[model samples]
Target chain A: MITPSPALPIAVPLVAAAFLAGLRKFLRRWLADLIATATAAANLWLCTALLRASWHSNIVYWFGNWFPRGRMVVGIGFEVDPVGAGLATLACLLTLLGFIYSWRITDSGRDLFQPLMLIFMAAMCGFAMTADLFNLFVFFELMSTAAFALCGLKTHEPAPLQGAFNFAVTNTVGAFLILTGIALVYAVTGALNMAQIGFLLGSRHDLLVIAAAAFLCSGFLIKAAIAPFHFWLPDAHSVAPTPVCVLFSGLMVELGAFAVLRMTSVMFGQSLLQPHSAFRATLLLLGSLTVVWGGLMCFAEHHLKRVLAFSTISHGGAMLLGVAIGTPAAITGWLTYLFAHAMAKAGLFFTAGILLHRLQSMSEPQLFKRGRPLRFTAVLWLLGGIALAALPPFGLSNGEDLIESATHAHAIHLWVTLMFFFTSAMTGAAVFRVGMRVFFGLGDAGPADRAAKIDEAPDGPEEQHHIPARMFLPAALCIALSAAPAYIPGFGRWFFNAAHRFLAQSLYIARIYAQPVHYVLPPAPHSDLGSTLMHGAIAVVCALLLASWAVFHLALPRGFRGATHLEGPMFPLRKLQSGHPGDYVVWCMVGFVLLGGCLFLLP
Target chain B: MNQIVHIFPYLVAGWVFLCGLYGIATSRHLVHTVISLAVVQTSTYVLLLNIGFRTGGAAPVFADISPGITTVDPIVQALMLTDVVVEATVMALLLAMVVKAYEKAGTLSPDDLRLMRG
Candidate 1:
């Protein structure tokens, strides 16, 4: 499975897509699905190989074996660090799951769907591993194009077109800003390879450099669904077919965070030396805002998919916060959170898909008492919610344990701790609210709502009893995968070391300059009994709060929707999510301006 | 003065980029907004081309160049070419999406598409 070069992961799927496309004219449906699975599996295997090769050092693959000119890296290269390999592998694994989740739906366009997913997978992995800035742009665009089409896949449905249009417009705008930024970076160095550009930059604190960095990150901020640039995410996720949502919510948005971290650490490493304080403060503010805003929105949202989308934003915020901390521990926590959230969120979305397929409605009130009988899915949903809530034994909590330690170490403990607790509680409570209301009919029957009575379950008891294996199986497997990591011996320590090495910019730069890294394996997790207990207590308390809220919901007065009062107080913030493309564009431009000012004027 | 001249195109690119954003924020129709997006995308073309420009440089064509003549940055031009292609493709995709939205919603104004909300 391991190859001599890092490019194998990218090349396999890129080639396989063309191969699949050629065979598409004559191939049957299952055959196309099989090819897609094979291709995804191979890419996954190669990613493991790449991770193995890059454990200690960076592996740079030059195109056509182009030799460097003296100290300059004249040729474009594909650099695979362990973090990159991990992310690349995550994309492959998610694609494989997404493919399997939809295997039973072999309609006429199934061939097209599988190939697009493959290309999307290729572009994502390619972006994760590429060393050249321009090539990164290319891969990003390819990924976005595939995502846009996939969002619009259900074209006959009125909502999807609207969603995809907003997605395309906002993302295209972000893309242009980043392209301009890349051109400016190239302007300064005449170098496309990121390491060479870093060397050329050499600690320059010029205005152009600041602008380029801001612009570069602004685009990714949009992609990451960071607040103010996050308008399109909910719409897109709500309308896109659920399988695609798994990829979009789980991996695609995370790539945006990956991009921001990559550019800062690898390309702008020197520029950050002087402006570190200002940069850190700005990012911390933005990250906190994203978490708070996203959590509050998720708490208020009623639509199931939209609620999940908001949760993704909130988790993205947490991930961004971890990256903004920019410590080895923080990065370690981010990796853990990213891995766990992807698995749990994907599973949650699959369950939502099943809700749509079986009940034909996405409304929470509509599904009340309808899903009551499906105890297995209800348990899966709650378990996933608990994992998402960062329960003590879950991977998310372990990530939180590491991150809260980072905050304490960095002396931002009080603010980050409060925000982290609030955000997680709110998001967890939102999911808890939905699970109880829809699955168990815990809430009051409000005004005898029409949606409450419109259950469209299959007529016969036998048919009603039938659960789609495709949906339930994938959900269970993904949830189990996410949960397994938390208890896996040494997983945390392994992740910690990978992250430490990832944050070691000078080492990465040296490796790119073809220097040996002298890799050292980090010691496995040890007892920090006090901090572990504290974090566990916080998680347990949050879980307790959610549980009590559900119990209290069951005790509430009839015909009352209790939380409508919560939004009344936050009307201004609610209005901020205007759902207009123009408004979203304004937010992005404003965010870009703020980002530039933060870089140029602050500190 | 010479430095300002050298930096002139980037200043223009910034202005054009802001204008495009302004247009998108104010525009009523989706088609017009996408065109404004295209205009913003054009700023990147200018930026890349200007970045690669030399004061007294020849093209990167090898046949007619003398031994030590400075050629403008060919790599950036290559980058710009790729950018144009991507721009074209994205525009096509956006326009297609616009058409679909128009057909389905019977409206091209973004203000009317406020269905999803917090």
Candidate 2:
């Protein structure tokens, strides 16, 4: 059997996307969707195959056979290690699930949707696989462009237009920063391939290198929606179509985390891995802030999609925390959490989409009890909330266990745990509040469950029966897969091995420079009942606190003293977002300057 | 003279980039914001070309040029072309969105587009 080229994962969808673009005008709707669906499914299979093929060693495929001549890398290479392959598989799997969920959506530009989606998938694959820094920037732009078009697909709505405009402006600035940083790196080292650059700059602490690190990381930090740079995400996620939101929150941001990790390790890992490094501490501080901010704002958010968006921010925080810790266990926790969040968040959004489709508005107060008697969706929502809270029956708990252990092992125990619990509970309370008000209708000042609004009929028997099978299918698949770390015995072992390879810079450096085929694997990962139980105990405490507010109505929102000023600090930050492209642009500039200063003065 | 020559482009690029950032911060209209974004993009072009510059170097194409004459790096030029294309595409899309948003809301001011809140 002929070995498939490493480029096929990217080439397949790109070729399919070109055909889909041409076919969009001539073909019927279902045929177009069928082609798109089949392509997405095939892409998923290809990604899995690539992962399996590259499981034992990294796969480095040079374009036009431009392998390194002696010491020089003459051409672009797509280097797919186990970690990159794992992330690529994730991007493909989520895109497949998104396409499945979008099967029922037949809007006017439905045809445009399929091609844009295909392009997005291809670019995501390219971004994950490419070893060239400049090529990574190209793929980043392609991915952002496709996503921008998709965000503005519903052109009839003013909100989507505004949201897409803000998203474009902010992300374009980020792309510029990344480009400039890449250029600086090239100027310093005369190489664009990541491993070559790492080898050239190994353990060096040049001022220019520090500036490049700041520039590169700031760009990705915005992309990953780290705090203060996260203003674009809630607007973009809330206004984008449901399936698009799934990719935005689920796959794209996680990919951003992966990018940041990749840049740090490959570019400056030798110099900046110390405990007192400013880079490490800054990441941890920013991550903690994001967790706190996203958690608090989620509870306060009135719009259902907005609530989910804030939850994405909070989860991004947890992932960032794990990344900043930079342990095998922490990274393993991060990857596992990325998986769990993708599923639970997508499922939650899918359930919320059903509500929005049935009821025109996404306002939580307005949607109260409108989803009544939809027992299956309600149950899914409840379980998704539990998993999101890192309570039970999902790999999120396992991920939480890994991250907590990493914190303690690093000896930063007390504050990290407290912050983790605080943030998780805040967002978890927000989700459960939606569960209480919308699904179960338990939190009412009065006993009135009567038909409140006319545009939305009461959730009668007809409504329950009318739920689309396709709509529920994707959510079910996601939820089931999210629970993998819990039920699958070897899930932790698989991640331990992957993380061991992923975190080892010399392994990557050697793969490119020397092509070492043999390697030693990390020890087999097993579950820690002790850590899991500790996490569960922490979650139970959070659940009880949330129960006081959500279930028993104790510490009632209106009854508390100084209730009016509760969001005092948040109000200023909210004002800063401003929904204006201009303000967002200014923030990006400030962020760039701040990043440079911080990196230049790193201890 | 040599130091000034090397430093001039860097200073100009930084100045232009900062001006563009300031324009975005202070602009009232979406058109102005888009224009400012183009200016920011121009700074990148300057930086790229400056990095590729070699004193007295001719254009990289050498089909008809005499032997032993140095040429500026062509790769940076290629990267600049890509940057310009991406900038143009983003500007056109942003302009289109601005037009649509104006049609829908009957205004172009950011202050007026206040439908969403925390």
Candidate 3:
């Protein structure tokens, strides 16, 4: 009988973050690790207890014990449903594991790292549990800001700084759009609580509502790094520290997809489920494009981390495609894929980190030349790669089977399913290529590669310098978790059922209020008319004209040299080295104007 | 008359918000961005207050005096107060980060700070 308290997880980390900020000078490096590990551990415990209790009952906490007076609810509230509770628990556990993974890295300022990590945890928990829109925005800001700081932890490195800067700008734009959407929705509904608003606008459709939904979805999509908005993801994930990379690629992007699920379910549930159509086509199109784009990009990349990053984007698209299908089986597939991918990706990152630590390089060619002696790391990485590629015996394979069987009847569904499978195969091939290079290629340690050798005295056992026991333990746990769904009967049902219920509840509400929602309508009715025609033309032209031109230009040797030269100068652009306040102001202004105009004019 | 009064504050808040956004968009300095964000935040606060306002609403604060006029929407006011606190914290933190950046980079021009790329 654990009483669900809303403030414990959020409050604990927030206070610890502030305290660590002040104690930076006295406690030094150990302080960050100690505080971060403790707070994450506490959060994990609290969420686990909440999960257990929530299995049998629901917990609702009201701010100041304020009850609704005449339908105008004044008090802020947090409700811990089974789904939210489960997600929160898993999020906390993974964050704790991530912190443990980073325990040995002393190069970065420990003081700042601990506080940022705590804030990140707090923000994530707050995002998962908050029932109010404005509060959601606040939590969103906290998480993004913390992420920005953490991404730039190693400021001396150009790659990390650039990656963090790009991530910051794009995500800030996304956040602004979310805020604008919130404001618009507030104007229309006059209620902050999600359930209350859903109830109030249950039977209405309007331009305002559609605009709001679009704005909100765009923000989350960018955060999730779904195709066109995905440019910032690879660099950020590849450049950040290994543990941070794992968290960013594994958990943070998923949060965006989760947000889209939550918002669509809560606000526009009915519209999404209309028998004839809704936003499904748009989602499917984006999802399929992201799948192909990510797979192809992975094939082109030489950097191990960047390849993993592209793989994440590809898998994210597949998950979104499942959700877009909006069927019971599809939702099941989505949840299953979410959990499985998190484990697999985190394990891969961990292994990658160990390799980088041992070899002092992330380049595939260099890594291949100086072969890693650690067989355990290779084995784990192979297992992780297999799971990521959705091979048989992996949980993702089962999830994909369910999704394919369920959606095989419809043409669009079938196409999407095929695309997803194709991408998975491509991803597997890419991983195999890299793996072959590293494990089987000729071992030619170049002249400069002398630095890669670890100094050990003659007749002394080779110093381990491998992954710490704590880190390896978690990686193994994750790998085991990835394999569990195939062996354990109905193990995934708990999460799947929760996701289904969430989707069903929203659909139920949307069905009830589909007619009165006159103000917030979508951009036109269906994707079958002018937009489809335009898309067809564009695709044809791109294939016929642009494709050949690109190939021809890329084929010439001078073209390759010229391209590399051009790319060399642009390398420094990645650092966000611009110290000019004027440019930042202009960028911010332009973003604001564009966002503001869209909000005001769209209706 | 009642409707007019009710809508007047919303209009004012909207105008103020637009102006603040404009300032934020045009301003070149880091401090200016913070100030602009504050202004945008203030617009929301005003809107919250306006939503809660009654024609002759009394102050929401509790005191020794007996309840006289209708108490304003205490809920909105409380939420607004919390928002102000959040905004203040965000502004202060941004300022601190800006100062740190200035110390390290020797300039605040975002255009000039090009240390990273693809």
- In terms of DockQ, the best-performing candidate is 1
Query: Could you give candidate 2's per-residue lDDT for residues A1-603 as a string of tens digits?
Result: 344677988889999899989877898878888888889888888888878877777788899989887668888898887788887788788788777777746373567888888889888888988888888999998899898988888777677887888888888888878887887888788888898888898898888788788878888888898776787887787778888888899888788788989888877788666655788787888888889888776665667778788889988987898899888888888888888888888888887766765656566667778778678888888777777877766778788778877766456777677766776677777777778778777755211111111122111223334667888898888878888888877788778777777877777777776566567875754558776767766775675456345444534656662322322324445556577777777777776676677777767
TM-score for model 3? 0.76
* Candidate 1 docking quality: incorrect, acceptable, medium or high: medium
DockQ for the candidates, in order: 0.59, 0.48, 0.25
lDDT of 3: 0.65
Encode model 1's per-residue lDDT on A327-420: one tens digit a residue.
7787888898899889999989988877776676766766777888788889888887877787666677777767777777456877777766
Candidate 2 chain A lDDT trough over 10 residues, lowest sum:
A449-458
Query: In each prediction, how many residue pairs overlap at the backbone (N, C-alpha, C within less than 3 A)?
Result: 0, 0, 46
Per-residue lDDT tens digits for candidate 3, residues B1-118, read 9889867876887787677657654555656655666676677767766666776767877685477758776766666666666556556655655566566667655444433222
lDDT of model 3 at residue A62? 71
**Candidate 3 ranges beyond 4 A from true positions:** A1-4, A28-35, A69-71, A442-466, A506-603, B1-116
Question: Candidate 2: global Cα-lDDT?
Answer: 0.78
Q: What is the number of residue pairs that collide in model 2? A: 0
lDDT: the better of candidates 1 and 3: 1
- Pairwise TM-score winner, candidates 2 and 3: 2
lDDT, residue B92, model 3: 65
